[model samples]
Target: MKINRNFDNLVPSYLFAEIASRTAAYVKAHPDNRLIRMGIGDVTLPLPPIAVEALRRGADELGVKETFKGYPEYEGYDFVREAVAGYYRSFGVTVAADEVFISDGAKSDTGNIGDIFGADNTVLVTDPVYPVYVDANIMAGRKIVYAPCLKENDFLAMPDKSLSPDMIYLCSPNNPTGAAYSAEQLRAWVDYANEHDAVILYDAAYEAFITDGSPRSIFAIEGARTCAIEFCSLSKTAGFTGTRCGYTVIPKELVRDGHSLRDLWYRRQATKFNGVSYPVQCAAAAVFSEEGLRQVHENLAYYQENARVISAALDEMGIYYTGGKNSPYIWLECPNGLGSWEFFDLLLNEAQVVGTPGEGFGAQGEGYLRLTSFNSRENTVEAVQRIKKLLSSSV
Candidate 1:
C-alpha cells in the first residue's frame, strides 16, 4: 500500500520545531544565560476565574446521575453556541447559534476543514501566513497559490480578480505579521469571493485584541455570508490555549456546488469528531458572560500593553514594522538588511531573546522577524531593554 505521496512535499522540519531546536542547543551550551522567548504566540495568562468556576461546576455535574452528560452535540450545545452568537452580536455582527460549530481550536478546524473539499480545488493563501493553512492544503495535494503580502500593502494581501481559487485563506491581525484588514478591505475580499464563487476561510483567532473597530468578524461585511466561513478560538480571547476550545461559523446561506457548506461541515464533524468536552463548552460559554469578558479583557489588556512597549521601542529605534496596536505581534524588518534567520540568531546570541524567523512563515517573510507579546509584563519590559541595548550598540 502506498502512503500519500503528498506528505513528502512538506518541509522536513516545522517552523517552531526548528526554532526550539536551535534555542535548545544554545541553552544546552550556555546553561547560565537567561533566554527570554518572544517566539511562539502561546498565551501566558491563566483562564479567567468565571470560566474556571464554570468548568468546575460542569465537572461536578458529571458526578450526579441527573446532570451527567455522555456526549456533546457535534455542532456544540445550544447554550455555548448562543454564547458565541452573542459575542458576534456584541460586535454588531449577527450570527445564528445553529451556524456555530464548537471545536478543539482554530488550528484544528482550519486544518480539518479541507476534508470536506475535493483535492482538485486550488487553494489561495497569503504569503507569510500561519503555516497550518498552507501545510494542510499541501497534505491534501491541492494546488496552492500564494498572494504576496508586502510592506507596500502593510502586509495585507488584497484579492486579484484575474485568478480564481476554490478556497481562500485569510487571517486578520494575521499570525506572524499581525496585520489586520479594514472593513472596506474585507468588503473587497467578500465581493471577490462571491464574484468568483469561492469560499473564503477567514481566521479571526485574534479578534479579542482588536480595539479599533476593525470588523472583528467577516460576517460584518454584507456579502460575506455567501462566501466566508470564519474560524475563531478562545485560546487568545480567554486564555484557553491549553484548555483548547474554539468555534467555526458557517453561514446557513452559504451553499456551494448545490450543497450547503454548513450542513456539509456538520456531517463532517459528526463522522470524524466526538465533540469538545461538556466542561470545556461550559467554560467556553462563560467567556461571553459579563464578568468573564471583563476578566479576559484585563488579561488581553496586559498583552496589549506589552505590544505597546515593544512598538514604542521599535519607534524609538526608527524601525519599520506593522501590528502591535491592534495585535499581540510586532512584525519588524530585520535590522541592517539581515535575513530572517540572521536576525533571529543575533537576538538569541547577543540579547538572549528569542523570536520567530519570518522566513519560516513563507517566501515573502524573508527579511523580517515576528515577536510576540505573550510573555509576562516584567519579562516583556526586560526583553525589550535587552533588545534595545543590543541594537543600539550594534548600530
Candidate 2:
C-alpha cells in the first residue's frame, strides 16, 4: 500500500517544533541564560473562573446516570450552539444556532475543512499566512496560489478577479503579521467570492483580541453568508488552548454545486469525528456568559497591555512594524538588515529572549520577525527592556 507521498513535499519541520529545538539546544549549551519566550502564540493566562466552574459542574454530571451524556450532538448541544450564535449577535452579526459545528479547535477545523472540496480546486492564500492554510492545501495536492501581502497594502490582501481561485483562506487579525481587514476591505472579498462562485474560509481566531473598529466577523459584511465559512477558537478568545474547543459556522445559504456546504460539513464530521466532550462544550458555552465575558475581557486587557509594552519599545527604537494595537502579535522588520533567522539568533544569544522568525510563514516574510504578547506583564516589561538594551548596544 502506498502512503500519500504528498507529505514529502512539506517543510522538514513545523515552524514551532524548529523553534523549540533551537531553544532547547541553546539552553543545554548555556545553562545560565534565563530565556523569556515571546514566541509561540500560546496563552499564558489561566482559564476564566466561570469556565472552570462550568467544567467542574459538567464533569460532575457524568458521575450521575441521569445527567451523564454518552456523546454530544454532532453539531453541538443547543445550549452551547445558542451561546455561540448569541456571541455573533453581540457583535452585530446574525448567525443561526444550527450553523455552528463544535470542534476540538480552529486549527483542526481549518485543516480538516479542506476535506469537503475536491483536490483539483485551486486555493488562494495570503503570503506570510498561517502555515496551516498553506500546508493543508499542499497535503491535499491542490493547486495553491499566493496573494502578495506587501507593505503597500498594509499586509491586507484584496480580491483580484484575475486569479479566479476556487477557495480563499483569510485570517484576520492575521497570525504572523497580526493585520486585520476593515469591513469595506472584507466586503470586497465577499462580493468577489459571490461573483466568482468561490468559497472563503475566514479564520477569526484572534477576533476577541480586536480593540479597533475592524469587523469581528465576516458575517458583518453583506453577502458573506453566501460565500464564507468562518472558523473561530476559544483558544485565544477565552484561553481554552489546553481545553481545546472551537466552532465553525457554515451558513445554510452557502450552497455550492447543488450541495449545501453546511450539510456537507455535518456529514464529514459525523463520519470521521466524534463531537467535542460534553464538559468541554459546557466550558465553551460559559465563555459567552455575562460573567465569563467580563473575566475573559480582563484577561484580554492584560495581554493587550503586554502588546503595548512591546509596541511602545518598537516605536521608541524607530523600528517599522505592524499590529500590537488590536492584536496580540507585533510583526516588525528586523533591524540592521538582519534576516529572519539572524534576528532570532541575535535575540536568543544576546538578550536571551525568544521570538518567531517570519521566514517560517512565507517568502514575503523574509527579514521580518513576530513577537507575541501572551506572556506575563512582568516578563513582557523585562523583554522590552532587554530588547531595548540589545538594540542600543548594537548601535
Candidate 3:
C-alpha cells in the first residue's frame, strides 16, 4: 500500500522552511540589526490573575484524592462547558453546555473537524485566507474552491452566485489579513449556505480583538444555527495560548438529510479524543469571570493600540490597507508593485521588522502584506518607525 499521497503534495514545510532560511540569512548578514517580529500571531502577555488563581486552586484540588479529575469526559467537564455557555450569553448568543466541545485551540478544532465530513464535499474559502481552512480541506480530499477577497471588497469574503459548496470556512476578524465580515455580509452568506444545505465552519478566534460594532459571533446573524458550527478560543481572548483551551459549538438543531451533526461530533469526540486537562480548563473557565473580563479587555485594548499605530503609519505613507479598526492585523498594499516575497525581503533587510507576506496566505494575497498587532507596544511603535524610514528611502 502506498503511504498517504496527500502528504507528498503538502506545501507548508517548504514555504515556512524558506521563510526560516531567508530570516536566518538576514540575521547572519546584519547581526547588529535588532529584529522585532510581528509575525506568527503569538501572545506576549502572561495568564491573567483570575485564571492563575483558578489554575492554582484547581491544581490544589487535584492534589486532594477526592477532587482529582482523571480522564475527562470526551464532551469536556461540565463546569468548563457551563462557563463557555455563559460566555456565549454575554454576546447575546445561545449555545448549550452539552453542545460545547472543549479542545486545545481553535486551530486544532479548525483542522480536525474535517474528520467527520465526507471527502466529496465542495469547500469554499476566501482567496487570501488563514491557510488552515483550505489546507485542512485539501488533506481531507475535498474539492477545494476559492472566492476572491480583494481591495474592492474591503477584503471581506462572501458567497458568489456562480457556485454552491457543501462546506464553507469563514474567519471573522480574520487571522493573517485581519478583515472582518459585517453582519449584513454574514447574513447573505448564511442565506446562501441555508439555500444550499451547506455547513459553514465559522471561526471567531480573533472575535475578542474586534473593537468596532462588528458582531463577535456568527449567531449574530439570523438563521446561522441551522447551518453553522462556530469555533472560539481563549488563546486570543484571554492569553491562553500555552494554557491550551478552546471550544466548538455544534447546534442540536443543525440537521441535514435527517442526520444530526451534533450527534456525529459527539461520537467523533468520544472515539478519538479525551478532553482538555482539568486545571487548564478551570483556568479557561476563569476567563469568563467578572475580573477576568475586565483584565482581558484591557489587554485587547492594548493590542488595539498597536493596530492603531501600524495603520497610522500606513496612512502617513499613503498606503491602502484593511483591518485596523476592528481587528489586530493590517493588510497593506505592497508599494512599488513589489512581489510579496520581494516585499518581505525588502522589509526584512532594510527595516529589520518581520511581518507575514500575504502570498503565504493564498493566491489572492499575491500583492499584499500582513502585519500583526500581537507584538509588544514598544516593538509595535519601533517597527512602524522603521517602516516609515524604509518607505521614505524607497519612494
Per-prediction tally of clashes: 0, 0, 0
Query: TM-score, each model?
Result: 0.99, 0.99, 0.97
Q: What is the Å distance of residue 56 in model 3 from its true position?
A: 1.5
- RMSD of model 1 against the true structure: 0.7
Error of 2 at 137 (Å): 0.9
Candidate 2 clashing pairs, residues 3+ apart or interchain:
none
lDDT of 3 at 320: 92
lDDT of 3: 0.87
Candidate 1 shows a clash count of 0
Worst 10 residues of 2 by lDDT: 153-162
**127-168 per-residue lDDT for model 3 (tens digits):** 888778877777777888898888888888778989989989
Using lDDT, rank the candidates from best to worst. 1, 2, 3
Question: In model 3, which regions exceed 4 Å deviation?
Answer: 12-17
Give the number of the best model, judged by lDDT: 1
Model 1, residue 269: displacement in angstroms? 0.3
- Cα lDDT of model 1 by residue, 288-388, tens digit: 99889999999999999999999999999999999998899999999999999999999999999999999999999999999999999999999999999
Q: Between prediction 2 and prediction 3, which has the larger lDDT?
A: 2
